[model samples]
Target: MPVHNMHERVLSMGSEEAGALLDSLSAGTADRLWPYDNWPPMEFDRPLSAGAKGGHGPVRYTVAAYVPGVWIRFTFTGPRGFHGFHEYAVLPVDEERTVLRHTLSMRVSGLARLSWPLAYRWMHDALLEDSLDLAERPARQARWSPYVRLLRALVTRVH
Candidate 1:
């Protein structure tokens, strides 16, 4: 199994604002940015910190590491085929400019090879773009194409 990675970044934010966005990745606040509002929101058994355990919907993971207002990584634990981590990071480019980056890197096995490309990849891209749009405020929403919408519809049914 080879690693499948997706990276999306949004610009023009302050580090504090970006960091706050990263901090908000927990159970209560994630829906405000991510497309979680339309799906099962990200959640955890405890506070957003290392050792916490949770994930969205049937995709389970653990809080592998976290740094308040900076970064947090989650290592996948379920769906039986994902192996790797996803992380949110805030990078300061200047006093008034920051970048919020989300990265998911994993090597899949078994059904994931087909499912990741045929299904999850599309939804993940749309959802990440929507999330970055939320982070990039004052900017328009990411244009969701009909294909993305169709994929969303299909995945929504599976959940």
Candidate 2:
């Protein structure tokens, strides 16, 4: 089946400011956008740009396209069954506001069809929401669902 998931936030900041946050992705300690404190850190073989390869934890992908602070797309390379890409986009809402969006579009096959719905989907949702929280400072933290909490516990024990 096909899956299209998105999480977005309208922040009281200019597009340039939001774009700066996008540029900070995977920048180690300098990164202020990804919620690495609560989840697996997003890492890449090199600085984020077109063709960069990396992913958080078990997921893997290569940067298929990049446009500085404006947008970036990553095409998946692992987990066996994810067929497609995920991306982040910065959209100017107004002079003082911008919309930051993360989108995951893919088709799952074989085990992923089951794993995605049973485990990955829940974790993905929580992670993206936390990511949005990080993008918008002073925002309320995104809460984890009971299932998500349980799944996280299981993964923690195994790893």
Candidate that scores best on TM-score: 2
Candidate 2 C-alpha lDDT tens digits along 73-119: 99999889999999999999999999999999999998999999999
Q: Please list all clashing residue pairs in model 1, or write none if there are none.
A: none
Each candidate's TM vs. the true structure? 0.89, 0.98
lDDT for each residue of candidate 1 in 5-76, tens digit (9 for 90 to 100): 656665777889888877777546444456565556888899888999998877899999999888889999
User: Total backbone clashes of model 2?
Assistant: 0
Best by lDDT: 2
Model 2, global lDDT: 0.93
Candidate 2 vs. true structure, TM-score: 0.98
Each candidate: RMSD = 1.9, 0.8
